[model samples]
Target: MKLALRKIRLVVHLLYGMWVVATRFARVTAQQRLELNRAWSLRFLQLAGMRLVVHNDGARIDEGALVVSNHISWIDIYVINAWRPTRFVSKAEVRKWPVVGWLAEQLGTVFLQREKRSDAKRIMHELSEHLVAGHVICVFPEGTTTDGRELLPFHANLFQAAVSASRPVQPVCIYYEDAHGNQSTAPSYIDEMSLGESLDTLLRGTPLTAHVYVCDALAPGAERRALAADAQVAIEGALDRLRPVGARVRQAAARGQAEQDAEVPHAGDTPAANGPLAQ
Candidate 1:
């Protein structure tokens, strides 16, 4: 909607969060901040009717780790943010979407104009700088959202950020479980749904349970792409194991399979919804 008006609310939230971050709960180190962030994320998910299933093998995801997850909906920001404060590397157009752009600014998210072919280089360069600086970054390697059933094929380019900065990239998967405890099969798309349409469609219905699974982190190196692929597989596998087999999940799998056949969003279909998400 109104971009100007949306920014105002973000400013308020930013100030409030900043106060809490800087004063009430002062942390000694970045790692400590991460711990606090995770606790907060857990609480956020609880309020959102979501649960986090983390399979952390004592793998400490300190300052130099990049979290890459499957894109599903705008809620991913809130889901991850509940766990930790992170910088998002997103499409440049997101900087104009009302309150979302303002929050991205406050959260130190970097936005690149994906509409231009050259923006990729700029994004990589920025990511390299941030990763080297020991900043925590979260990216959606799928580059787009899907029905919450299966992980889309990994976008290899986003994995390069961790390699460029010698940081580990972790894979995380998120899904929705309805009241009956059945997992949601699919979700809204930015290009396919606007903020109003999305909220209307989502809120009008009964709330669904959200699930976030954090898998073991991967090492960043020449095999970054391979790691990304493995992470996607791991998330999908974990999701499958957590929930029972359902027809929606099967259909979602088929949709992903068909996309691979046609090749989807090579680099420039990213749309701006309201924030650190797809259109």
Candidate 2:
């Protein structure tokens, strides 16, 4: 019954979000839009029963930063927005994803068609312009979501926008954990999962805690591939630190050691009468 009510509230909240973006998004200033985006995202996470914990160890650049992150769940977009509302560079397919597509469009997401060279150039130009105008733009350079265990290689094409605009590339790492503090895959939106299925899984797995680590920024003007490589390394390191050592593995190792120790006779132990030497 509690879960049902939570799902109902989430639906209503999503509808309310659609209405706000449809009705009032056009009337608001850029700053107002960002604040509204952040507030709405924070509320959505709260209603979805997920808590966000942010660790900003790097220099804070409120604007003009090309924020890059490793993608895991669709929730990642809102997670970052809950911290600092920034425009996103998403795949063109996302621009057609029912209500989500509309929201992304109205909320200033720049969509890219990955296979088209012309579209790539156009979107890159647009991203550079946004960064140069002091707007924070974020991209999931991995091009797709993962299980949050490891980072895929980052695509270097988008990193060129930061270089062209001379803006710092801020790499943010995010992963989820359960109440027991073990790294959780509950929030992962990978595989052939539909949006409805993903939402159901997320809502069912309540009380997830999302960790966002904003690592030190890689400076601009570096080679794009090099920048992407460095960002991948940074995020990989962050994920390694975030995930705990598995209890099962530790237990297995301990049991194996004990079995090996038992096989060897101790200094005070006498050999068995039926042992090979006794014969």
Candidate 3:
């Protein structure tokens, strides 16, 4: 009964968000839009029974920076938004998603068409413009969701936007935990999981706390791949530090799974691996 009530509230809140996007988004200033996004995201997290705990080593770049993070679940987007609102780079198909898609478009999401190789260049150019305009652009370079035990390779293409705009790259690390402080994979949206299935899993779990660690920004170097590599390393180190004893065990198991998966050439591995838009 409690889970059902929470689900109802989430649906109503989602509807409210859609209404706000349809009505007020057109008239709001850029700063107002960011604030609105932040507020809605925080409320979404709260209603989902998740709390955000952010640890910043230093202040985030104010003038505009490319924010990169490991993709764990769709919830990762909101957790980051709850900390500091950022315009995200998502795949083009997300623009066609039901209510959420329309809201994402209105909320300043830049959609990338991943099918055509040329699209990456186009999206990169678009992202560069956003950064030049002093907008914080966040991308999950890992492209797809992971179980928070490890980070997949960071696609270096999008990192070029920051280099082109001469903006810094902010690497963020996120993981979830249950109320008792044990690492939780309850938020991971991996495998062939449906959105409804993922939500149901979360609704049935105990209250969760999302940890967002803001690592130091890397300078806009000459090479995007170099930047992406460095950012991935930074996030991996952060996640390692964030893990508990149980999580380490899970990580070792996950490593074995990764190795086995790598040996098999699956259809899921392709350019599209880096194309998913966030939740």
Q: Give Cα-based local distance difference scores for all models.
A: 0.68, 0.87, 0.86
Write one digit per residue (lDDT tens) for candidate 1, span 1-279: 343444344356545555656574543565665566556555544543456544443553758788887777876777777655688878777788765666566557888776787888888889889989888788888888777656768888878888878888777767676767777643345566886566445443335666667777787665666877787887777676667567557767988999886654445666446545544
Best by TM-score: 3
Tens digit of per-residue lDDT, candidate 2, span 54-158 = 886555578899999989898999899998899998889999897778889888899888888889889989999999999999999998998887788899999
Q: Which ten residues in a row have the lowest lDDT in candidate 1?
A: 1-10
lDDT tens string, model 3, 1-279?
A: 587898889889989999888899789887887798889999999999999988874757766799999888878878988999888988798888777788788788998888889888889899999999998999999988988877899989899899999999999999898888887888889999998889888777659999998999998766988999999999998888788877778878988999988766467655334355323
List ranges where model 2 is wrong by over 4 Å. Answer: 1-4, 245-279
Q: Which is superior by TM-score, 1 or 2?
A: 2
TM-score, one value per model: 0.71, 0.84, 0.86
- What is the TM-score (0 to 1) of candidate 1? 0.71
Q: Show the lowest summed lDDT stretch of 10 residues, model 2.
A: 243-252
Look at candidate 2 and give me any clashing residue pairs.
Answer: none
Q: Candidate 3: TM-score?
A: 0.86
Task: After the best TM-score superposition of candidate 3, give how far the Cα of residue 3 lies from its true spot, in angstroms.
Answer: 2.4
